[model samples]
Target: MSYKKVSLIVLGSEAALKRALITVIIGGDEAAKSSYLKESEIYENNNYKIIYTPDLNKPSKDIKSVFVYNKDHDRSLLVVKEGFSTGEVWKQIEELHKLTGKSTEEFIVVLPLIHEHTESYPFTCLKISNLFSTISKMAEDRRQKATSTSHADHPDDPMKVAGKPSDSRVNLVLLGMSGSGKSASGNTILGKTIFPSKASSSPVTAECQAEDKEIGSSWVRVIDTPDIFDDDINDFTKKQHVNKCKELSEHGSTVYLLVMHVSRFTDGERNILRKLGEAFGSKVHEQTLILFTRENDLMQGDMTQGAFIHSLTPDLKKIVTKCDNRCVWFENKAPSSGQVERLMHVVHQMLIFRNNSAGSWWRFSR
Candidate 1:
C-alpha cells in the first residue's frame, strides 16, 4: 500500500484524527469477508480480538476488539476507491480531520467493502488481506502517536517522575542460562543482528548488554544478561548482574523474557524460576514470559510446540504456568519478522496489562 493511501486512511480526515474506528474498504469476490476473516485468524492467534461486522450502523464499543466490516458504509474516514473523486475525498477527509482537536475516544474503526466489479473505479484498491495488513499497521501508528501526544500534553510532574514511568518504552530483559540463546533472542526481538550469537561451551554474554528498537508504535529495549542465576556463578557477580538489570529497567515498563532451550531441561532449570524471584522479587513472574529457543528440538520429538510445553514435567509446568502461561518459541539460527512481530505482540500485551493494574503497574501471580 502506498504511504499516501495509509495517510489518507489514517490522517486524511479531520474527523478521523480523533476517530476510533480504522475503517477499511475491501474489494473482491463474494468471499471477501470470509477471506478477510480467515486472514484475521493470524491476528486472533496473537491474542487480538477481531470483531466481524456486516453492519456498521451498530458498532460495538469493545475496546479490546479490532473491528472488520464490509459494505459501503458511510464513515468519516477518507475514501480511496478507484474512479472516486480525489477532490471530494480530500475535502471530506479534511473535514473529518477537524473532529480530532480534543478527541479522547480510543475505540473506533470503520472498514467498508466494494466488490471487484467496482475495480475500474479510478483509484486502485488492494485485496482484503493487503488492505487489512495496511490498516492494522496504520492503526498501531495512530495509537502510538496519540499516546505520545497525550504524554506530551500532560507531562508527568517532576516530583512524581521517580514513582511513575516517565518513558513509555517497553524494557525487555532476556534472562536465562548462558548459551540459552539470550543473545540470539535479543537479536530476534530487534529484527537485526545487533547482538552477537554463537555456539559456546562457556558463558558468551558475560555482562549485560542492551539495544533498543522501535517496534510497531512503541520503543522496545532488549537487555541480554548472563546466566546470573546459575549456581556456578559467584554470588558477588550475580548480585551485580541483578542490580544492573534493575537499573536498566528503572525508568520504563519492563517485561522479562526468560529464555531457555526448548529441549534442554537441566537440574539448574528446575529451580530457575524460584531463583528469579529471589534475585528480583516474588512478583517478578508477573512481568516475565518464557521464551523457548531451538524449536526444532520439539519437532524432532514429533510434537507441536504447544503439546511439548504441556507435556513438560510438573516442575517445568509449574514454572511455565506461573508466568500466566505466556511463552514464545524461536529458532535462533534463523530469524523471521513474523516471529519478531509475534513476540512484540506479547510484549505489548504485557505492557498494557502492567499499566492497567492497580498501584503497582504489575500484578502478582495469582
Candidate 2:
C-alpha cells in the first residue's frame, strides 16, 4: 500500500504525555480543539495514539478519545488506551504470546497523543510540538495499497474476493538455518536483485538488509538475514547478525517467515528452531510460521514434504502448533503469483488473532 494516504502518525506512551494534555482534555474549549485540528493539517492528518493508557490518567478519556480524536480530521487519530503502565502493555503481550504465541512484531503501531491549550502546562508548546513532529514523520512515510490482489477460486464468480490486507508495510523476516534459500526467497519477494546468494558457507549475507517495494497497493519489506545456523560463526558474530537484522526491520516485522526448503524438513531440521529460540528467545518460535520453499521439488521428488512429515515428524508438527497452524508453500523458482498475497493473508489473520483473544493476555504451549 502506498503511504501517500497518511501524511503523519504519532505513537508513544500516553502517561508520558498525560500531564501536558490533561488540561486541554478537561477544559474542552473550542479553541483548544481548533488548535489541535490545525496542527493535524501540518502532518496531513497524522494519527496519534496513547498506547496502553488509562482513561483516567489523562484529564478525561471520553473528552479526548471522542472529541480531540475527531478534531484533527487529517490522517491523524488519537488512540486512547485502557491500560496505564508499560507493565500493563507487557502483561497483555506476554499473555498474548502464551495463547496465540508472539508474532514477529506483536504490535504494529504505537502513537502518542498531545493536545493544544497548554499555555499553563509549563512545557506544553515544546512537548506538543515534539510529539506532533515525531508522529508526522511516521505518517508521511506511510501508504496503503488501495487495491486487492485476488484470484477467483471458483469459476462461477469472476470477482471472487481473494485475500487482501489492510496495511502492507508489514515486514516478514525469512529466518532459519543456512542454505534454506532465505536469501533467494528474499529475492523472490523483492522481484529483483538485492541480496547476495550462492551455494556456499561464506555467509554472503552477514547482516540484515531491509528493502521496501510496492506489491499491488501495499509496500512489502522483505528482510534478508544471515544464517541462523552459521557453523563457523562465533557467539558475538551470531549476536551481531541477529541484532543487525532486528534493527533493519526497525521492530515493525510481525511475522517470522521461516523459509526452509520443503525437501529439508528432517528430524535434524526440527532442531533448528532451537537456534531461533536461542537467537531471538524461545518465545520467538511462538510468533513463527514455517514457510517451506522449493515447493516444486515436492512434485518432482519421490516423497513430498507432507508425506515426509508424518507421525514420525512430531517435532515438525510441534513447531507448527506453536504458531497456531500457520504455514505456507513457496516455489522460489516459479513462485505462484498469489504467494505474497497469501502470506500476507496469513499475517492479517495472525494479527486478528490478538483481537479475537480479547485485549488481554493469551497463552501458547501445553
* TM-score top scorer: 1
- List the candidates' TM-scores in order: 0.58, 0.49
What would you estimate as the lDDT of candidate 2?
Answer: 0.51
What lDDT score belongs to each candidate, Candidate 1 first?
0.57, 0.51
Which candidate has the highest lDDT of all? 1
The reply for model 1, stretches above 4 Å from the true place, is: 1-135, 140-166, 354-366
Instruction: Report the C-alpha lDDT of model 1 over 1-366, residue by residue, as the tens digit.
Output: 212122221222222211212221221111222223321221121112223322221222321122223122112223233234545643433333343321212212222222123324322333322344455576655444544343433233432321333476678999998878999889878878887788988888878888766666456678989888789878999999999988877777788899988878788888998899999899999899999999877778788765676588998889988887777789877766667765765665565444342211111122
Total backbone clashes of candidate 1, pairs 3 or more residues apart or in separate chains = 23
Expressed as tens digits, the lDDT of each residue in 1-366 for candidate 2 is 433333222322453333223222221121222223321211122223321223332343322343344433232222324333444544444433343333314322222211222233211112222333444345434422433445345433211213233232567788877788888888887877788877895556777787766554335678888775766678888888888777765534457888777666654467777878887777886568778788787678665444544432577777766665566677877876566655654554455443343211111111
Q: lDDT of candidate 1 vs native? A: 0.57
Worst 10 residues of 1 by lDDT: 39-48
